[model samples]
Structure formats: structure tokens, C-alpha cells
Target: MNTNKELEYCNVAVWFDRSTLHAMMQALVEAGLNVAWKESQKQFRVTVYTQHGTSDLTLLRLNGAYKLDELDYCVRDMRLALVLYQFIEQAKGHAIVKMMNQDKIVVKNIRYGEAVRIVEIKGAEKKVIYEKACSVTMDQVIAALKRRDAEERIPVMRLELDYELATLYDAIQAKDTAQVKKSKDRLKQLRQEMLLLEA
Candidate 1:
């Protein structure tokens, strides 16, 4: 109900189920914040206790729509904003992870080039969000998918090397001599490729 201009805080309007919104509030409560939901106004009043002082925030919710003001308590409050942001992100991430695990979403393809990389993700709605890879590797993509945190990116070469190393370990554990040999050779080659890229 509050306008962005009036709030003057980083915030987002999201439509989600009541259960999902409750889960986010639970996360904040678990992090040592006092939260109370007011049915009359359909808002949540949150009190954050810090070493310096206590801060308060009001999260407006109606039906499935919700808005959380990041800088509600303090102007330009990076620390408080980060804490709330991380909680919201983690909640959203978990939901995405569940969807991916259930096959509701899928990664269509990944194309890598000299200067850029492209990742294509397809959801149940048939909508796709194309992400440009900025040093993002396949391994990081896999990790992000599993964790539901797509914003975390790392170098492609490093990811490839780590994957090969992991494969080598797995082969060793399985006592598959052929696989171990193959993984070792692949890892060696990856290392050389990484060196060339770095140079």
C-alpha cells in the first residue's frame, strides 16, 4: 500500500502463498528478531535488536501480495538491509530448489564463448530467464541450482577443474581403475587449459 517514493527503501512487491510468506517471517524470527502479524492492517511489525540500538520495520501483506522495506528502520542501513535481504533470498532460494528437484523447472542449455556465456532456464510457465555469464562456471551454476541461489557466480575454469577433481575422488572411492585413470587425465588437461586461459 505504501509507495516506493514515500518508503525511500529498497523493497519489492511479491505475490506468493500465505505459507511461503509465513516461512520467511519464521526465518526472521529464528534469527533473533521479534515479529508480530497484525490482522487488521495485514502487516507485520518487526523489531530488530542490535548492539547499538533496536530498529523496527513494518511489512505490509494483503492476500498474496507483500512488500518489505529494507531501510525502514535506518536510512542507508546496509547491515539491516543485508540481513533482511538474505533471509528473503534464502526463502525464495529454497522454494526454487524444491521446484527444480520436482522437475518443475529445468536448465535448457549453457553456451560458453570467448567473451560471454549464456544460461537458459525454463520454468513451468514456459518462461525463460536468460543469464549472461560473467566468469560463471558450470559447477557454480549447478551449485546455484541446487541451493536456489543463482546470483552466486565463480570462474568457469575453476569450476571445471573442481568437477574433474571430484570425479577423480569418486572414481577412487568406487575402485574403478579405468574411471580413475580417465578422470586423472581429464583433470590434467583441465589444469593445462586453465593455465592457458589465465596466461
Candidate 2:
């Protein structure tokens, strides 16, 4: 991995049932959606990668009524206001959710239920969810910042690198073997390369 580089997002895939996937895909196609990627399995369900922001994958679950355990995974973005609204309208029944991620977007429902046209994001909305649901990653944010900075960077990184190098030299003199081995060597080289890039 290039330590200096970053990425915006990964290939997010949406999963649901075969019938529901087919229906949504059909609706999207009719709505003039250009699907980026998709695959289906009757034994399991359907997974799709879309060109748009997020795809609806509501029908995949049969509620707690299914023979499976933790059926909430059937609904991907159950926390997303629009997705939740639509899913609730589609699923019709009060959807069961085992876990919801930080973004309130992707959810892990162990069960699924009936299908319809999702009504509102929160005929089933809740407050005080976990931070783990959806939060910006350090690397992703850093990558975005670096992308904006390009080769010539800002004063803060300069200060951080200077502080790191000083700390590295101090550890070397103090014979802090663990810090020397873990941080000093790689950090020194990387900082020097970055400094040269800056100059």
C-alpha cells in the first residue's frame, strides 16, 4: 500500500432476495438506472453494485419468520432515511434489526418480511445509535486531504513530520529499542522521502 495515497470509497455491494432483487432491478431499469454490476443465486439471494448512490435491496428477508438466524442482514441500508423509509413501505411489517452501523445506512437484520413500496424512513426511525454504524475512516479522510494537497503540502504535516523525526532521534539516543525498531526506522525514511518531495 502506498502510505501517502488514499481512496474515496470501496466497491459497496447491496444484497437482497432473488425476487426482490429482480423487482428492484426491473424498477430501476424502467426508471432508467444503469446498473454497474450484479449477480444472483436462488439458493441464496442477489447482490448488486450500482452506478447510482445506493440501491434498494428490501425483499431479501422474510422477518423473524424465516428459518435463518439474524435475518436483518437481508436489508442493507435500513438506517438510511430514504432506504429505511422505502424498506418499511416495501417490507410492510415492522422490520426487525439485529444491528445497525454508524451511518445508519447499512444494517444487519437477521430476519426479513413481506414486500411493498417503502413509505417513510422512520415509520421506523430511532435515535442514539452506535458510532460504529457509519463514520468517516481516518485513512479515507486523509486520502481526500492529500488528494487536495497534491505533492506540495501544508504547514501542519510539516510540523508533525518534524516532531516525529525529533522524537525518532531522541529514541535512538535513549536506546528505546522498541520505539527504535517500530517507528524510528520506517518513519525516518518515509519522512525524508516526503521532505524531498516537498522541496
- What does candidate 2's lDDT look like per residue over 1-199, in tens digits? 2222211111122223345445554655554444443322313222334332544332223321111112233323222323433433353223433333333333322111322112112225654332323233566545555564532343344445557778778889999988778666666555444433332
Q: What is the lDDT of candidate 2?
A: 0.38
* Predicted structure 2, TM vs. truth: 0.23
Q: What does candidate 1's lDDT look like per residue over 1-199, in tens digits?
A: 1112111222232223456557766765676555555443677656665444666666566444444534223323334444544544543211111113233433322111121222233453564455443544666445445653221221344456668889889989999999999988887666444423322
Cα lDDT for residue 87, model 2?
35
Please, what is the TM-score per model? 0.32, 0.23
